[model samples]
Target: MEPMGLRERKKLATRRTLQHEALRLAIEHGSENVTVDDIAAAANVSTRTFFNYFSSKEEAIIGDGPPRPTADATAVFVANGPTGDLLDDLKHFILSPMLDLSAEELGYTFTDFLARKQLMLRESHLVTRMMATFAATEREVVAGVAARLGEEPEAIRPQIVAALGMTALRFALRHLHHHGDTAEGAGAEGARAAEIAELRDLLDEAFDALRQTFDTAR
Candidate 1:
């Protein structure tokens, strides 16, 4: 992959600083209490600049997620280099991107994401907006996968397959938050890595199930 332009790199750095500051402040004070101005000040950026990156305070705290970490895997699948086994391709695409996150960038505890999820859930308005973004992203990913599989993008089978994949991923993330590196009682990086590994295993199993049900049925 090509290196990021200097300006793009700087922008990413600024965005990360804002996100990190926002998360830290939210963790320290309640999410409700932290204002956009406060986060901007913490990140050394103007409040308007914060708006340029995120739509709202909630988004700043836990929005604009990590870029798809496994694009290479997705590219391989998209190219149909493996005879178009969508399930296998997806498994590789999904898991491989995570490996790209630097250790420090990957340092987030599953527990923290869980806490943020819970907190965001309580904010129904923000939750609603965030869900819209998620849904749109889901469809885009599904369409991309469907295209690679030579399936009609709008076909029920492709949509259903995408839904199943998404559900399994969600379950895996929840499991990580509840029992793995993100267990409520733990806060260490070691625990976090273990949780991530467990989540990956679960995803792999889920993909296996998907393949068995779909590929075998066909």
Candidate 2:
């Protein structure tokens, strides 16, 4: 990776600040209620500058999130580290960058929103939109990974693996969000590391059980 100059670093910091403010405002006021002007004011950036960073208010709240990588970036990230095993590669590909989120970031974005949505599932539209975006982006990521590995992108197993991994991730996120803490509770996403671990373990166990059932049928 090329070293970022001071100017570039400053730009990124400003962008992050803007996104954070946008998210905070959206959580407080609802996504539709938080306007670009509001985010720009909160971040101390002009509305024009806010437009330079994000195309829409929703983008500001989502803030180039981990699950939605651009095609080129996803290709590069997938190709950089190639493990021979497909499952391990899938897990690494999906989970690595996610590990970078600060505890506060997770709390603000996910953990705090879990319970109300769990009971009401009122954010189904938001969830659907995010999942669709994630699926489309992740398909590109897997295609790049498959190309690098000399596997056909249309091959059944690879497609199935990608789909299953995505499902597990969404499930984990919803589980953590709904059950970890209500929007009013403390500890937020910071204290849910253990829960995350357990969710991952459950995914593995579920996969193992499916494998055994297939073996028995075969």
On TM-score, the candidate that comes out on top is: 1
Question: What lDDT tens digits, residue by residue, belong to model 1 across residues 1-218?
Answer: 66679999899888878877887788778788999999999999998999999888877777554235245556676787455666766655555555665444555434446666766756655666556655665675677677776888888776876677666766666565445434455544555455557768889878777767866899
For residues 1-218, could you state the per-residue lDDT of candidate 2 as single tens digits?
35569999789778878877876776777777889999999999899999988898876665544444334445654565445555555655666544545555544445433432442253454565445556675676568566656678888766776777676666555555223444336465634464456556655655565567767999
Q: Which 10 residues in a row give candidate 1 its minimum summed lDDT?
A: 63-72
Q: How many residue pairs in model 2 have overlapping backbones?
A: 2
TM-score: model 2 vs. ground truth: 0.67
C-alpha lDDT of all candidate models, in order: 0.68, 0.62
Instruction: State which candidate has the highest lDDT.
Output: 1
Which pairs of residues collide in model 1? 69-97, 70-97, 181-195
Give the TM-score comparing model 1 with the true structure, all chains together: 0.76
Worst 10 residues of 2 by lDDT: 111-120
> In order, how many clashes per candidate?
3, 2
Off by over 4 Å in 2: 1-8, 67-83, 100-120, 123-125, 154-156, 177-199
- The CA lDDT at 108 in model 1 is 45
